[model samples]
Target: MLAVELNGDAVRAKNGSMVAYDGRMGFKRLTGGGEGLRGMVTRRVTGEHMTVMEVKGQGTCYFADRASNINLVRLGGEKLYVEASNLLCTEEGLRTGTTFTGLRGAAEGNGLFTTTVHGTGWAALMSDGPAVILRVAPGLPLTVDPGAYVAHTGELKQQFVSGVTWRTAIGEGSGEGVQLRFEGSGTVYVQPSERTTLGGQL
Candidate 1:
């Protein structure tokens, strides 16, 4: 569960994520994740659908989804790339949109686009287990499993790597053949457990 304190300020959260609240609060569903008609149309076309609600009041509001563990991230003019299902909440001042991720998204079974959040604020990300933050530097690149990816911050380049060979195509190779390779400078949030992704067993 995530607790957010609001003092005349507002926040955008996943719809129906409010489990409890204290003091006076109002919840209004935001169409197309509050990006307006253009965003709605973009989401529909890209298949990155997100239903969000605005929570405004002077109290502490609690949010949770499927009892998943929450990770708090503070962004200072940086961008966060995450899957729509893993994002829980964000400050109202932040901007949210969808961006194409190409093969990486296809391998994760999350379609060809992913959600992007930017600006200086706080955002809550959900994962099956406690999230692990890994850093990617200039010389030190990071490779990750698509099923374990949660979100990432900073400037980084993501590449789809295939380890599948003739042996894997047959039956002698390891199940873990595809991977997401990250290079540059950024931090990646990964879950301890893997989700059921298209490349999980490939």
Candidate 2:
């Protein structure tokens, strides 16, 4: 569970993720994650959906989702690519959008579009287990299992790398088969426990 204190400020959270609250707090279910009509249309067209609620007023609010471990990311004018289901909460100033992730998103069965949170604020991400933060630089790139990816921030170029071979047809393939390679400068959050993905079985 994550607890955030606000003094006349607001936070956008995953709808129905609030566990508790104290003092004067107002909860409003946001249409299209508070992006209004255009965002609603975009989300409907892209099939990347998020139900968000805005919590405001002076008090402390607690948030949780499926008892997953929560990781807090602080952004300073950088873009964060995350799955809609893994996103927990964000400060009101941050803007949320969607972008195509190509094969990487398909590997996880999460469609081709992924949620993007950009601007300067704090956002909370949830994972099945404790998430490891990996750094990627110009010389050093990070390749991640699609099932383990939770979120990432900074300027990163993602490439789909497959380890499938003739052996894969005979059920003798590496469990870590397909991966998403992240190059450039950024930080990636990966969970210790992998989610069940189509790539994991392939």
Q: How high a TM-score does candidate 1 get?
A: 0.98
Clashes of 1: 0
Look at candidate 1 and give me any clashing residue pairs: none
Put down candidate 1 lDDT per residue, 1-202, tens digits, no spaces.
9999999999999999999999999999999999999999999999899999999999999999999999999999999999999999999889999999999999999999999999999999999999999999999999999999999998899998888889877886677888999999999999999888887776
Q: For model 2, what is the error of residue 108's alpha carbon versus the real structure, in angstroms, after optimal superposition?
A: 0.9
Q: Supply the global lDDT for candidate 1.
A: 0.95
Per-candidate TM vs. native? 0.98, 0.98
Residue 70 C-alpha lDDT in model 1: 99
lDDT tens per residue, model 2, 69-127? 99999999889999999999999999999899998999998999999999999999999
Q: List the residue pairs that clash in candidate 2.
A: none
- TM-score, predicted candidate 2 vs. hidden true structure: 0.98
Top-TM-score structure, candidate number = 1
